[model samples]
Target: SAEGEELLRKLPGYLAQPGVTALVFNFVDQLIHGRSEHAILHEVARDASALRSLTRTWFEESALMRALREAERRSVPVLLTTDHGSIHCNTPATVFAKRDATANLRYKFGEDLRAERPDTALLVDDLPSWGLPQMHLGVRLLLALSDHFFVYPTKLREYQGRYRGAFLHGGVTPEEMIVPVALLTPRSAG
Candidate 1:
């Protein structure tokens, strides 16, 4: 807490000395980790509205916004983005993956990963089209569609229960693939 404040205090000096200074904020990431396997998992997990409320409240009151306000006061530019979008997963698609498979919930990257055609999608033969590099020869990406998530056949019930109703990404959907990018310039600057 105080450490972050100290960083902010030193920010202008850092900006003045160097060619470029980059300040990256991950407010939503902290909220995501707070909700899952980090903090009180049950609170937001049980009540869906808790996620929305927490997000809105944090955006309005968090120091990340305060830092941005300070930047705006100094007439600095603010650009906002998210690493990836997530969707509330419902359906489960059975896939076969090796032990060393890339263990993402919505996608699997491994050899011989298979799922039903209607249930999931398999992208092999090429990765450049998607801008994803294949890990190795014959390596492929198996992606879940719609609200579906990839679950290994082993311990199927356990994995399904663990991921059901959770927000996740790695596959394709309008919400997951499409992201909003905004460059914030204060009206005073204009």
Candidate 2:
């Protein structure tokens, strides 16, 4: 713990670097690993209240508070945002795709991607129209809808056992699509 605190103490200096237009720190790993797994396996609450409690503890214990304190002391502006949010996916939708298809639990993009349960996924054949760059011809995107994750029939049971109730993004659900963005001005600057 002392080592961790020592590492975090350097955050202020890192943020104060000269000519640095912006600096970013990624704490998503802390959010992702073991959060849903523990919640699902231990039958803890998986609702927003639980998330708020967990994140509250994390912010208090982690470097976020220190970062905020440094920013305020230096009168720096802070921008908080997430590329996407995650959802607790319960259902596994069987999908068939080429061997080289990208293997994300929540979505897949490749040629000839098809879900056995069509209702569980939203098929987007027009990648360009969706603001996704077309890597090649026939590069369709399949986004698992609601709380479903794409799984291969060959390893359906294994995937279900491992990923059931896991929090994942890259889907077509509101939880994944609607993310938060906040611009914070330090009180001294404000």
Candidate 3:
């Protein structure tokens, strides 16, 4: 990571600047990679502990932590949040769609989208009621339900083998909906 360390070193300069500053750190890649590896090798359900441990380790060893300390030293109020959370998708649901459909496994929107197992998905034909813009006529939203991940029928076996236990988002599960928001103030500021 020495190659990438310099990029994060710039954080301090940004933090030192006057006016409201917003810092964003992306820990999703590591979480997803770790979870996918575990799912591929282990039969145990996607373990939250593994992700928690990974996050803790990343915070302790990464330059971001030093930046946090720097912010604290400067008495900079910190607000940390995530746009969305992820869920372990173990159920593979078959979906039929045209070649132009979106490829994301968690959700898809296209002129033609239908789940082979209707119970495993939620289909919304009324896009406007949901506040989603109607990109085109007859466009519908199909969301995988519970722990299900969508896989095209043409390559069901291939996709299932690769993404059966992967961590994915864009679903309606509690894990995907609920995220943490932390507001931290330095002791010196108080």
Candidate 4:
């Protein structure tokens, strides 16, 4: 982590060097910690506000910010984008499977699958029209949820307690998918 931070710190210098044309800042789904469900639900949910707080803090302190600031100072162009988004699951969708099943709130993987709500965009059963090749349910759910994922009720308390103080974004909902793209140029020194 320290090394990561150090690398981040050097980003500004890296971009400031020369021959760099454009920089794209794509803060994708749960830009903070989508990799860890437990971390997303537990640590980030503890806070009352949205998880973007953590991202804000990162931008303030991380090398990414430093790089962007340098680019701004130099009058370089920057573009920000996200491939998809995520959602916080307030309603639990029960997925039944045998023991030794892999469990993820956003999606699940197992045999003999069943869900509490049939409305779920089943990957194996649905989404072929979207041109995505057939994959496991988890992968399908992941794609379908694109900016709107699941949040289980079983971990609601834990999520409320732990993730109360972080930033997260993903889900089909507007908040996650509908982000802004900005172009910044340095103010004239005149």
Candidate 5:
């Protein structure tokens, strides 16, 4: 809780130290809150405009922004990226099972389950080719769905409730897999 802020305050000193050549900021799942996770998935699935706003808000006020600013002040080389992206799920294909059911908009899980068109959704069955640059794909997919930070389609309702409404980002897609890396340094040095 408070430790996050405390740690953030000390980051500048940590980066300013000598011998710290490169600083890589990995901000994937932390960008989205637990309550608004599914919102992104719904928005991405049907609305392009919403996605743009979501993306802007994510980069602007997220932890990534805090770290980026600190790194820039210290003139440290920074690379920003993710593991994967997620797809919005509208059609809730029936997944058969005995236990509780998860509430992820992009993906779901249970004991014994099946989907009419599993291919349309990004699941374990489509990891090889669909999952590329592992990191980016993971982040994008998770952020698009629900939060809970990193909740795979394993546990049923418990995890679902924890993540439902939050934004997530892992999975295999262009939005999640293909991320840009920007290098920021002092103007004088540049």
Candidate 6:
């Protein structure tokens, strides 16, 4: 964190003078965006061990973590959580829906939904029973299961080739449904 040491030294000054001290870091967003925009997801998906190492390294080396260490030095408490989890999708299933149907690979909410691989998706008339309050007539919910996710019938091959090894979320897999909660206290806490 030598690169961040200079910035760390300056943080206290800003915090001391600030009327309202607030800091927001988008470190996780940058990683997720890197997965989507870059080929990092595909590169890592096939190698689970490599992916794990990469993630651990990224978190340890991140400036955000450096900042956290600086805060810890000043006896600050930190709460961290994620909105959702992601899965390395393996199962492929094509779902039938209208052209204007919701364009989410993890789930689909549309009318007359049909899946080539029926077991891969959970098709319900509405989303209320699934913990979502929103409901509508003729609107159905199809949540993908396990490593399964939705793919369009048209250009299916192209889509699959592009997304087969990509990590994605918003489905019903355990990885997608479960979230982690972390409360970090200073190591020197008495």
Model 5, backbone clash pairs (residues 3+ apart or across chains), number:
36
Tell me, by lDDT, which candidate is best: 3
lDDT of 4 by residue, 1-190 (tens): 4654676566667666777544445443445464344654445544435455756765687656776666677666666555555554444344554544455544544455555555653444454666656665543333224222333455656655444333344334565567667656567532
Better of 2 and 5 by lDDT: 2
* Candidate structures ordered by lDDT, highest first: 3, 2, 6, 1, 4, 5
- lDDT accuracy of residue 50 in candidate 5: 65
TM-score winner among the candidates?
3
Q: What would you estimate as the lDDT of candidate 6?
A: 0.73
lDDT of 3 by residue, 1-190 (tens): 6633775677668777888776657765555755556654334334666656657877798776877787899888888788888887889999998877898889998878999989999999999899988788878899878999998878889988888768889888888889899988999999
* Per-prediction TM-score to the true structure, in the order listed: 0.85, 0.81, 0.86, 0.56, 0.49, 0.78
Task: At residue 130, give the lDDT of candidate 5.
Answer: 58
What's the lDDT for all of these models?
A: 0.72, 0.78, 0.80, 0.51, 0.47, 0.73
Q: Provide the lowest-lDDT 10-residue window in model 2.
A: 39-48
Error of 4 at 170 (Å): 6.4
TM-score of 5: 0.49
Q: Choose 3 or 6, whichever is better by lDDT.
A: 3
Q: Which regions of candidate 6 deviate over 4 angstroms?
A: 1-33, 44-46
RMSD of 5: 8.5
Shift in Å, residue 1, candidate 1: 2.7
lDDT of 6 by residue, 22-119 (tens): 55555544555456557755466355566667777887887678777876887666677777887877667999998757988888877888788888
Model 5, 39-129: lDDT tens digits are 4555452344565576677668755577777777766776544445543322223333334435444444443334434453434423345
Error of 6 at 111 (Å): 2.2
Steric clash count of candidate 4: 29
- Mark the 10 consecutive residues where model 3 has the least summed lDDT: 37-46
